[model samples]
Target chain A: MHRIALQTLLFHRAKVAAALAGVAFATALMIIQIGLYEGLRSRASVLVNRLGGDLWIMAAGTSMVDDSELLATGAELPARAHPCVTSVRPAIVAWVPYRTPAGARHTLQLVGSDLRTAGPTHAYVPWSFAEGLPQDLLAQDRVAIDDGDLSRLGLAPPLVGSTLEIAERRVEVRGVTTGIRNVSLIPMVFADVETARTLAGAAPDGATYWLVDLADGSCGPSVARAIERDPRLDVMTREELASVTEEHVVTESGAGAALAFVALLGLVVGTVIVGQTLLSLVREHHKELGMLRAVGASRSELAQFVAWLSAFVAAMGGALGVILALLVQSGLGGRSVELHYGPGAILTGLAAVLVMCTVAGAASLASVLRLDVVKVLQ
Target chain B: MTDERGASANVLEARGVVFTHGTPPLETRVLHGVDLDIAPGELTVLMGPSGSGKTTLISILAGLLRPTRGRVVLGGSEISAMDDAEVTAVRRRTLGFVFQAFHLFPALTATDNVAEVLALSGTPIRVAREKARALLTRFGLEARLDHRPGELSAGQRQRVAIARAIVTSPRLVIADEPTVALDGPTAASVMELLREYVSAGTSVVLVTHDVRLVRASDRVVALEDGRVAYDGRGLAANPHGAPSGHDIHPPTPRSSEPVAGPEGA
Candidate 1:
């Protein structure tokens, strides 16, 4: 039966090729759409995700990293007093006016962290620097910008040492990072807490959020609850904060619903195309199928043959589809809407393609099982 | 009534076999009450005009159709009473078939086409191919073993189909117009091959209108208006095997014309 399945599919090269191509196109579409959605979610929570913390304390009702009121003075006191707390770092995140070198005005998100309190790799600091070091931002009036934002910031490549103004205060670009993007298209600028406070007209002790690290034996949920006692502050574990931020952004932007619809459309269209092709192939080979039945092949045996054929198509087409999606992702590098086709996305796409092919194969198999052997013999 | 060989010796028996198309008022009867017995080691040719129900009878006998009434017993199993799967199993174990269309798998080589049946019956593919190779070689197809159906001539394709039919060494071989599409020489060759299988204790039921082939058969059962019009050992006998009245002779040399009505039901 396996031999028959393989030989018959190979014999109908044109039809098989068309099915494969349809499956590949559909799989790629699904992967790419899912990758884009993941990318969007990741970017929406990029700041909170990259900052090394087990828990976060912020002003009450703060929904995301960028939209938060300044925490009341000494909001970190409750978290620091807890025995499970190792350290609490005050960080400043605020939107500030930017004046490009071309005299064009724009708004940039300013993130302020004290690098002296933690190391460059495992702190509330962004990594993947294209040039310069995290310590450079610690210098007074120095800031870091993502290389991806250079064009929109009106700054060219080799951005290190380039000067720009934030809130009418001149700040030198001391470090450039890669892959740090905001879905809102707002350029993110990193600086020390003092510079960010002075530029954003915030008081020296004001902080938008307090990032908390826990001791090895501590549970984040317990510590978060312990700190949430203060009525003016809300606390969340890092994972919870990331999830909430992602959900908030997706809901606010409406991109999730739109992308899901497109992905669903791809699935339906792919299923229809592959299903119709297999049905037509079955019709074309009706005589052969009838002969098999007339010669003593049971319904299950015929179904197994169809299943094997569908499996082959799904496996091969899914693999090709993933590769194509990766190629597309690579091509879109540094673009505004980056795509991330990780292992999860690839597996999901393959599963969808397999289901599509199975549905198609079963439709054709029904026709085969209902074959009229006597009529065919005549 | 049993012949000299007795009913116990029969390889197949069709008792009051009847078949109808459609249902209720829309029904059209194709076979009334077909009673027949086929003994092993002889070639039986089913003859009839168009709409005479020869095809329907052969279909029922092959277990490809369920008779509306009565039962068909083949090789000790009542196939007409069996479910489709059970009848399929019986066909696999005891029956072979050669159709006018040859129905060979177009993608497979001649050897693989013949090997598929043995494989279907649980023989290892390697062993099945070996057996198929031997059978086709015996049938003078060794040179064309690797050729697909499209690459083979009509005579060669028929020979391949024949090889595929008998590779499993079934007890009965049913064929419908097996040589109707062949020339005199090709048809004769095919007949000779089937006769050889018959001599080896495989009963053959052939549905054909070819006069030369009919005259060569050991028995002829002629159908008319969905009933057996004549059943005899030789065409020279009268209808119903009585030695007296009008005799059934072979169709004239222009045998392309059917023996009775137009060809097929």
Candidate 2:
């Protein structure tokens, strides 16, 4: 069929392109705006996602990774005894500084784990670079430095033969790996349980928390019941821990509010921009539209033409915005601004399209709807 | 308002028509009970002075305006009391319009501009374009089929407008002051095109104050101060009529040189 919509679109592509560009920018900004919060929250709790444990036993309200100090490590025995709880590990986590042989100091999330029961907690850590596992880490003063920490140590990347001084103790950097990092942009340092305890001068009787893992599906309630039998323990499954983490990011930190503000600003700015551009174009074409109506084009046909133009531009802007975001964010500060595409991003973008395009179209319609076809018959 | 039954083979007929402009309190009534009939296969010129309601009368005859009191019938349908939708349907199905300033779409191809009416009425694009091309060819505009309005000459643009109007094969073509900008010869050729449409059996109701146009007109209705002051088939008025304020409300002749080129040799 002859497409009045397509004809009009071709006629107005320049104005449409300009309008769509605004939406594209808004899309990019909205993504990046939300990304800032995601980025910061990821920084605040990198250990949650990366922590290999299937369940976390922390203080009742402590969800943030850096919220608590070492309690009693023996807290795991109660949860481990549950029929649903197959394994548990005692893990030590702290923020500390280390000086490499190159003499540069960098902060690290120093984690200590027992080599034997480490499957529940330590599996997520990058530990292959370490010369050995949790062989009394606080005993011998040996250290496992992440490649990022090693780079900051100015040691020219990881070398098994290097040494470091952490917590006023000299230690060998016997291993190197990736993906282990600290909250607030720090690197990670790994050491054996005993050696880390000795190096940090920690009391062995106290532990960070018991990292628990269940065997299979539907084990959460039974594990919770068994762990609750102990007054000192609070058991949370993986999803629950994630939820708590989300709550921490949303409520406890101001980052969430700021991101929301920026996203809203993006939408408003886009609405203004898209609305202005479309309305101007509509004004320019109002006489022509009047002529068309005078000659027998229906109001529905005109509306369809306009709506299709908007949706095409919006959808194009959406796709272009996503591509541009990825392109620009990848090179930002030599670091990738992470884009997490869940179902929510799609919904958010669609909302942006509807809000932006509809507002723009409505603005244009203010003038367009009055196109005195009667006045224009000549 | 009532249709004039048994009306001659005229494509449009107006009986006792009255028209007014503006809203109440500030409104000015223009036309006062005018009567007219435009026969099929004939070119009729409607000429009048500024504020004389010639454009208003033409607008009513084209089914674009509903007369306040009397009836104007187009394509056998009385239009004075019809709703906007019904009026539009009659115009789309039976009427074509050619204006002084060619209203070719500035962005569309010549062929596409001609084809637009069919598309608005749901004609498939390919066939509509094919018909548009054939119409342009008939008008000797085939070579400029892809040119936009901005690219065409004054005469060519008007030709394109004529092609666009007639491409839909409307039985009635209403033209309003089609030569206010053209030289005498160009205007003459434009009128010749209207005459060609008449020869092809399309009725034309042309509104102009330019007397040069009356030569091609089979019948002429001269309106003055909102009434039909003269109605005949004589071509003997001012051999060169100037622009009416009705179309382009004229200024004080601007050095008496407002007329372009020469009048008829």
Q: State residue B118's C-alpha deviation in candidate 1, in Å.
A: 1.2
lDDT of 1 by residue, A236-346 (tens): 877888888898887666888888888888888888888987888777767776777777788788777778778878887888888889899889887888787788898
For model 1, which pairs clash?
none
Clashes of each: 0, 17
Best by TM-score: 1
Assess the local accuracy of residue B261 in candidate 1 as a C-alpha lDDT between 0 and 100. 24
B123-171, model 1: which lDDT tens digit per residue? 9999999999999999999999999999999999999999988888888
User: How would you encode candidate 2's per-residue C-alpha lDDT over A49-103 as one tens digit per residue?
Assistant: 5565777877655666565566655667777677776777666677677676667
Candidate of highest lDDT: 1
| Model 1 residue B20 lDDT score | 86
Per-candidate alpha-carbon RMSD to the true structure: 4.9, 6.7
What is candidate 2's DockQ?
0.38
How accurate locally, in lDDT, is each candidate? 0.82, 0.69
Candidate 1, A73: how far from true, in Å?
2.8
